[model samples]
Target: MAEPSPPSFPPGNYDLSSVDLDDDRYEVKQSAIRNKYTIRDSTGNVVLRGKQKMFKMKEEFPFVTDNGEDAFTVKAGGIMDVTGNYAITDTGTSEEVIILGEDFSLFVENWTIRDPDTGEALATIQSKSGFSRPSDTLSPL
Candidate 1:
């Protein structure tokens, strides 16, 4: 079967200039054992860091800033949950940003991000083959 054409957006319809840019670029470095990950910037300055510890029941990974301030955390859920089942929370306000779940199909595997409060889908990401080109425009779901 022929593949569907990629979606397109008209020119000047969206303003790309006013979008906020991330000033600090983070580079993640993981240890050989995958127990620790350090985030550094372009100048080799540590910006954020994370550490994980193994346990019998559950495992939790917390990411912190250079000053040892709590940034966010990821905690594993029960085994009965889906593949991407985990709880991710922001440490500052104690708000959950994204709860991930996986959906499998015959041709694609989808990773969905849902709102923790209402359980509504916020975004869906699908794995694509390396030879496939990305669409130039994005539309709201």
Candidate 2:
């Protein structure tokens, strides 16, 4: 059987300009066996945050929403997993928004985020998930 279609937005796209990284603090152990990165905003508000699991061969970075309401995590092995409600506001009547990813090659599986009204996809932000190599591309998390 064919897979179900992804949900759609109402009319306009969700504006991500309001999204900004305020500030961040991280700690690395002497052994470098484990590391934690916590990001906060200018007002000390955590916008996006994550943790790293280091190993001899590879590392994994998993992040979640600051409020802990929703989670969007990425692994060092190129695995991205997103869950929970991502908030957005629009002046328009349409209650839908678009979640644009950094690239097309990124893979998303076992992920779900949607608009409460229509149960449609508001946005999907992930590149790839699973045991894979990391890319040189640099972009905000």
Candidate 3:
């Protein structure tokens, strides 16, 4: 028999391949102090969990699979990096898979997702409106 899932993750056989290819809609939840975040699929199942320290000059978010295995790590730009970009590193390969660059804006945050190795743009995650951050990871999917 297999070991039971951890309390941090929901119970089920989480397939990362399914999450990467099939899933189109995912709800992202964040903690109030801006330290942790959880991503859920359209079926309202927790797919990924990420956390970082509450206070840091440069933040680093270590993400894990639903089964609590290492998945990826997102490191924020250093103090000298004016763009305030974030690099997503694949834990297994130890390579930067994606780069999220914060575009300067007067009112909202605009992020560009890029291919880290090739330096090619992939997609963009723009803040449509002011996000009313929740304290916990409980929201409608």
Q: What lDDT tens digits, residue by residue, belong to model 3 across residues 1-141?
A: 984332222223222322352466667766656568898888998888988765555667688878888888888777434356788877876767668887765555567777666667666675545643232222211
Residues 20-101 of candidate 2: C-alpha lDDT, one tens digit per residue: 3322332211111234556555466556555555442333344455654333433232333222233333223323342222
Which of candidates 1 and 3 reaches a greater TM-score?
3
Comparing 1 and 3 by lDDT, which wins?
3
Better of 2 and 3 by lDDT: 3
Candidate 1 accuracy as lDDT: 0.56
Q: How close is candidate 3 to the true structure, as a TM-score?
A: 0.69
Lowest lDDT sum, 10 consecutive residues, model 3, at: 132-141
Residue-level error in angstroms, candidate 3, position 28:
1.5
Task: Name every residue pair that clashes in candidate 1.
Answer: none
lDDT tens digits, residue span 1-141, model 1: 985443332343211222211333445555644447887776787877778765324546787777787778876566323244667777765666667776644444466767676777766666553321112011000
Alpha-carbon lDDT of model 3:
0.64
How far residue 26's Cα lies from its native spot in candidate 1, in Å, is 3.5
